[model samples]
Target chain A: AQSVSQHNHHVILSEAASLELGCNYSYGGTVNLFWYVQYPGQHLQLLLKYFSGDPLVKGIKGFEAEFIKSKFSFNLRKPSVQWSDTAEYFCAVEAAGNKLTFGGGTRVLVKP
Target chain B: DTAVSQTPKYLVTQMGNDKSIKCEQNLGHDTMYWYKQDSKKFLKIMFSYNNKELIINETVPNRFSPKSPDKAHLNLHINSLELGDSAVYFCASSRVTDRFGTEAFFGQGTRLTVV
Candidate 1:
């Protein structure tokens, strides 16, 4: 079975600090990757996705993810993070039949 | 206007009771899905319907069934709910386009607590 692993379970950072959440998957085929964010008391929303073409994909709120096929990793990054960026981030991989296998999720707390 | 909506944002019930969670999408998407988020915040797919047809059933229990009356509506019915059924159920829809992969839009989850 395919699985996604997010190394960071919880991350705390001050405002304006850089952010990077590591995500690795166990699959060796044409794959689609995504990063979703859930704000406090809100539904999950897509931050970015990578199906094909460029490995580096940019998303809303200055979020970006790079799909490194060789490493089997798609990590989410941001040059600077704000307090509003505090949320739980999930990395998901599209498996056979379009089913998504999500990671354990990483909760980010950005201090103001 | 909300794109995807699920009714009864919070549900509290006793074990062995029957309950249902309603979901509707106004995005006009062909594919809709039901996902459960456990207390640990791990999200897993429970069922998926495309154009009112069952597409993916992730080995879910028979006690839980999904009904899609149309392309825009998918409701989940639980029979004899158990204490282990306590979790947040989310309804989401995605437009399956040839050019791009499916990007799901989620609704405010219905948090169910079975005592």
Candidate 2:
């Protein structure tokens, strides 16, 4: 079974600070990666995704993730963050089927 | 308009009770899935149905069953719920196409609290 690991469990940052969340997965075959975010009371929404081709994938809200096959990592990064960026972020990987294995989410708290 | 929706957004029940959460997707996707978000906010896949057929069934207990009457609807029924079953359940749907890799759209989630 494939598994995902998120090194950061919680992150705290001030407004305008750069943010990065580490994500790694264990899968040898071709994989699809995704980053999903959930606000305080909102449903989970897709932040970004990496299917194939370019390793760097840009997503909504100025967020991006780079897929490094050698490292088995797809880390989410943002040049700058706002107070509204505070949310729980999840990293998910799909190997063959439609089933997505998600990592333990990382909670981000941004101070304005 | 909500793409994917789950009924009874919040459910509170007692142990040993039976409960069902309904999920419907207006996106007309071919695959639907049920994921359980635990207290620690770890999302785990429970069941997945593709085109009204059961495709993926994780190590979830037999007490929990997923029924898909059609491609757009997948309902989960839990029998003899326990305290450990208290968690947020999310329903998601995706279109499986060969050309493009699709992403799953998640529902608002049903918060199940068992006493």
Candidate 3:
């Protein structure tokens, strides 16, 4: 069974601060990576994804992730964050068709 | 318009009762899934159905049954619910073909609370 690990369970950052959330997965096959964010009282929305192509993929709200197959990591990064960016972020991977394995989410608290 | 939707966004029930969470997707996707997010926000896949056929059944208990009436809907029925079943359930849909760059879209999640 494939498993995902998120090193940061909770992250606190001030506005305009750079951010990096570590994510690692245990899968040897071809894997698809994704980053989903959920604001307070809002549904989960896609931040970014990596299927095939460039190792670094950009997403909404100035977020991006680099898929490193050798290290089995897909870490989410942002140059600067806003107060509105405070939300729970989830890292998920799909080795099979549509079934996804999600990591323990990291709650980001961006203070202004 | 919302791509995926779930009914009874907040469900409060007693233990030993039966409950159902209905989900519908208008994206015309062929695959749908059920995921449970625990109190700690750990999301796990419970079941997956493709074209109304069972595909992925994770380590979920037998009490949780997913019924897909068609390709656009996948409803989860829980029998003999327990306190451990109290969690937020999310419904998601995606294209069945291993299409690159296509990610599953999730619903507003039904928060189920069992007493």
lDDT of each: 0.83, 0.84, 0.83
For candidate 3, write residues A1-112 as lDDT tens digits.
Answer: 7888999877888999999999999988999888988665344667888889999999999999999999999999999999888877889887753246677678788888
TM-score for each predicted model, relative to the true structure: 0.55, 0.55, 0.54
Better of 2 and 3 by TM-score: 2
Give the range where candidate 3 chain A is weakest over 10 consecutive residues by summed lDDT.
Answer: A96-105
Which prediction has more favorable lDDT, 2 or 3?
2
Q: Return the DockQ of model 3.
A: 0.04
Candidate 1 lDDT over residue span B9-95, tens digit each: 889999999999999999898888898975435466788888999887987899999999999999999999999998888888776
Fraction of the reference Cα-Cα interface contacts (below 8 Å) that each candidate reproduces: 0.00, 0.00, 0.00
The root-mean-square deviation over C-alpha atoms between each candidate and the true structure, in angstroms, is 14.4, 14.8, 14.8
Q: Ten residues in a row with the worst lDDT in model 2 chain B?
A: B95-104
- Candidate 2 per-residue lDDT, tens place, B86-115, comes to 888889877533322233466767888899
Docking quality class, candidate 1: incorrect
Best of the candidates, lDDT: 2
